[model samples]
Target: MITPSVSDPSPRRRSEKSRSATLSAALELCAENGYGKVTIEAIAARAGVSKKTIYRWWSTKGAILLDAVTELVASGSPLPDTGDIEADLRTHIGSLVRLFTSPVIGPAYTGILAELLHDERLARAVNDELVIPRVALVYQRMRGAQEQGQLPPDADLPLAVEMMYGPLYYRHALGRSYPDEQRIETLVAHVMRALRTPAPS
Candidate 1:
């Protein structure tokens, strides 16, 4: 049989496998050692790939960590939208609480947030990759609610989005879990009430 062509699928398959392994290794190292202690060399060693392979795909360890997290969040279940704004907000809040309390992703996120104070680039990367997408989803759903008259058309969606999420994040940053469904549901209901429009005088 003739030899395989230069543009063979085998090399491409190996490249994809190496990339996935690198991401998984990065996540595992971050979870185990915390973000500050993890390094590219350790990731390469854990991934069984050369350092060059990682550099070829990522500029810094932070970037790799971000990719690892973005992959997880992107692959997670989509935010629910059953048309009842309050219930949907509660569902999304519940999902976010679970994500932040997760053994793997939670620590990784907090570790990065701690690093963010020192490294502006890492902060920007995290904001662009992690925060914006989630915020965008919330914005879209809330804007739709405004359109549906569930919220006042004049309601400030951006602020409402922040208000809905800011407390949960603050609690996570303080190392406090959401406590229970009752607490989260109560918070969601309160936010919904604040976002609702008043009747004309």
Candidate 2:
């Protein structure tokens, strides 16, 4: 067993602190100035860290913004397993609606996603950082429902997920509207009806 010096700042701990500071700064700048106006230098200045530090961690402001959004989403309630998939899904969808319609994070997310349209790499990173984890949660919940005989074994989890969230994303992309509670209820019901397994003869 190798004993480390007590005064030594562990590299991993320092790295984590740096990362958290950078994300916080990035999110703040994006929210305050809109994503289009935020620069790496601004983020570094806000974070009181070096621009090189930001560059060493992320290749673009888009990547940092995605990380911040992912952090925000992950901090929210996880998908519920309340034995009622519809209710659980409604709650999840409602949370997403609120998140994307909020005054702070909403504009930030919208700006970053708009930028993502022209940058394939940034889009991929956003998908990896933001979309995939949320999809995995929904997929996992759907699989559990399948095990409970709520869905067919061959239930198209991915398609069902898209059906549930695609419209929300579309609305945000267009900056035209947002789903109210009734709309969320309708979407959840539609997806559930589409996803449920038929009764056996």
Candidate 3:
């Protein structure tokens, strides 16, 4: 009896399988060997695909990592809104700090920043594709807090948002600070203090 050829499977199904495997390989290699060390050949070899196949989907290693990070974030980690801006900010910001310092994704993301400094296209993709949408959700939360009297009516929500996340990114991503539970709480409290409305006289 003759068996059906592997190519008998739908091309779309095979394409998706290859895509998922490639992304998983990229993430694994990035975690094991820093992003700077990850190469298209390495990802292809790990994923059991060919270099041409990787290049067919992604141009650079950074591009592949960007796609991986995008998929990770899109799954289930949006900023939470519980009708308490302070709680939401603390949870969101702390989660970001942890994510940026985690063994798996942190290394992968660190190298992306270096490329973003020089690669204008990747920079835009990182900002427009990854950063803006998440930040926009935080902005919406800030607006809600302001409307509900948690923050000042005329507070600089955009600037405040920057201030809130900037230090965490700078310390963890750029500098090298790892926030513990106490430290995260302190930082959250600081942000809350800055944004909280004053009590009536």
Task: Rank candidates, TM-score, best first.
Answer: 2, 1, 3
For candidate 3, write residues 1-201 as lDDT tens digits.
555567576667788999999988998999998877898999999999999888898899899989888777665466777887877877787677667777777787888888898999899999988889887888898898888888888677887778777776687556577677777678767776766645455
Q: Residue 175 deviation, candidate 2, in Å? A: 0.4
* Pairs in clash, predicted candidate 3: none
lDDT of each: 0.82, 0.85, 0.81
Candidates 1 and 2 compared by TM-score, better number: 2
> Mind giving the per-residue lDDT tens digits that candidate 1 earns over 87-140?
888888877777767777776777777777788988898898888988999899
Best model number under lDDT: 2
Any runs in candidate 3 off by more than 4 Å, and if so which?
Answer: 1-9, 197-201
Name the TM-score of candidate 3. Answer: 0.85
Displacement of the residue 192 alpha carbon in candidate 1, Å: 0.3
- As a whole number from 0 to 100, the lDDT of residue 156 in candidate 3 is 72
Once model 2 is optimally superposed onto the true structure by TM-score, how far is the C-alpha of residue 181 displaced, in angstroms? 1.6
**Which runs in model 2 stand beyond 4 Å of their true positions?**
1-9, 197-201
